[model samples]
Target: MLINELSKKTGLSIHTIRYYENLGMIKGLADEKVKSNNYKHYNNNTIERLEIIIEAREVGFTLAEIKKILTSWFETTESKPETLELFHAKIKEIDDKMRYFKQTKRLLEKVCEKIQNNE
Candidate 1:
């Protein structure tokens, strides 16, 4: 399919897809037979890649980090130590954030209880 279809399927804007392409996170190929325009065609693999990108971003991975993960996981023969290290670090970050989330939730609950008592 084309960029428009890819955008529809992925729920991302054309500009975002082009930006990912520019960042080398995903690629689209232009047809060799067509001589009129330089429209790029995307495949199913591109859809999977975009889905990964979207999920990774939702979990707070930067584009560069996502690129590294995709490259290491898909394009490489062996797992790189740095990639492993990066994942470990991300896990630690998430753990720390989880603690904060629990604290915030508790505080909100206490505030809600106080408000209920006063009313």
Candidate 2:
């Protein structure tokens, strides 16, 4: 399908899809038969790649990290253990950040209470 169709199917904006394509996370191919305009067509593989990108980003994976993981996933199966390890590390990082946020929230609440008491 065309880029517009792909965008609708993936629920991603055209600019975002083009951005990913520019970053080499996905690719679109121009049809050889159509010489009137340089329209690029996307296939199922592009959709799958975009889905992977979306899931990874939701879990806090940066684009560079996602690219590495996708490269490994597409190139060979030897990186399965490594990918699992990365995910575990990301989970730990999230846990640590959540604890930090909780502490900060409590501190802010205490400050607010102190200000109200002084008033």
Candidate 3:
């Protein structure tokens, strides 16, 4: 599919898709036979990759982190320790955030209880 079609399928704006392409996180190939226009074509793999990117972004992963994760999937020679360390750090961060959120929830509940009791 063309970039527009890919944008529609992925629910991402054309600029965001192009930004990802520019960042080397995704790519589209130009047809060799079609010389008149410079339209690029995307495949199912691109769609799957975009989906991963969307989910990762939603989970608070930086673009750089997402790129490295995707690269590690393709490049077996890449350093496993580095990727492992990144994941480990991310896990710690999320855990810390979860604890903080639980504390905040408790505080909020206490405030609500005080309000109800006119304290």
Candidate 4:
């Protein structure tokens, strides 16, 4: 399917799909004929990779990190364990950020309440 179809299927915007391609987060279409078109076509495999890439980004993986992971994944299927380890590390990082944000929110709420009460 074309980029538009892939975007619809992936629930990602067309610009974001292009951005991912530009950032090397995912590979472009393999066919030369398809490459001539302004928009690229994608297969099921590409779509699946895009899904994972998008989810990983949502969990705060930078484009550079995503590119590294994708490259390793494509090079060898054995990289699964390493990929999982990376994801676990990212999860821990996100959890730490969440904890900090919650604390900040609590502090802000206290300040707001104090200001409202003029105390």
Candidate 5:
């Protein structure tokens, strides 16, 4: 599929896809060229990678982390342990964040209730 098809499938704009490609989030895509009218073509693998990258970002994985995972997948070493460790760490981080947010929410609710009672 081409960039437009990828954009439709991934629900991301072509410009954003280009930006991701430039940012090294997704690799092996063609660079812009004056030839072929400056249009870029993408394969199914690229589309799949874009989907993974989008999901990873949504789950709070930075571009550098995603790039490391992708590179590991491409490298000679198997990445199962590394990927598992990364996900486990992310889970812990999210759990801590959730705990803090819950505490903050409770405090805010108490404050709001006191303000309402006073008014």
Candidate 6:
């Protein structure tokens, strides 16, 4: 389908989709048979890729990291050591962030209790 349909299907804005395209994360191909406008078409694979991209972003993956993961997972035959290392590092970062979040949550809870006590 066209970009508009792809946008509707992916729930992403046209600008964001274009940005991804520009970033080399996804690709849209123009129909060669048509001689008029260079309208780019997307397929089911594009939808699947966009879904992965959305999920990865939600999990705090940067675009570069997401692109690397996508390329490694989709375009390559075997998993690379670098990709494994990157994922391991990301896991460590997420663990550290989780601890920080827990600490912040506890601090907020204590502050709330103090406010309730008027202390």
Residue 84, candidate 5: how far off, in angstroms?
A: 1.6
| TM-score winner between candidates 4 and 6 | 6
lDDT of each residue in 6-97, candidate 2, tens digit only = 99999999999999999998989998998999899999988999999999999899998898888888877988888888889889999999
| Cα deviation of 47, candidate 6, in Å | 0.9
What is the alpha-carbon lDDT of model 5 when measured against the actual structure? 0.81
Best by lDDT: 1
Residue ranges of candidate 3 with Cα displaced over 4 Å: none
Query: Positional deviation of 43 in candidate 6, in angstroms?
Result: 1.7
Residue 10 in candidate 4, Cα distance off native in Å = 2.3
Cα lDDT tens digits, model 4, 1-119, are 88888888999998988888887776666566655556556888879789878877787898777876887787678878888888899889989999999999999999999999999
**TM-scores for all candidates?**
0.81, 0.87, 0.85, 0.72, 0.80, 0.85
**Alpha-carbon lDDT, every model:** 0.94, 0.92, 0.91, 0.82, 0.81, 0.92
Please write out the lDDT profile of model 5 over residues 62-87, one tens digit for every residue: 88888777777656378768977888
Ranking by TM-score: 2, 6, 3, 1, 5, 4
Expressed as tens digits, the lDDT of each residue in 1-119 for candidate 6 is 99999999999999999999999999999989999998999889999999999998998889999999889878995767778988899899999999999999999999999999999
Clashing residue pairs for model 2 = none
Top candidate by TM-score: 2
Deviation (Å) of 45 in candidate 1: 0.9
Model 2 residue runs over 4 Å out of place are: none
**Model 4 clash pairs?**
none
- Estimate the TM-score for candidate 6: 0.85
Q: 1, model 5: CA deviation in Å?
A: 2.5
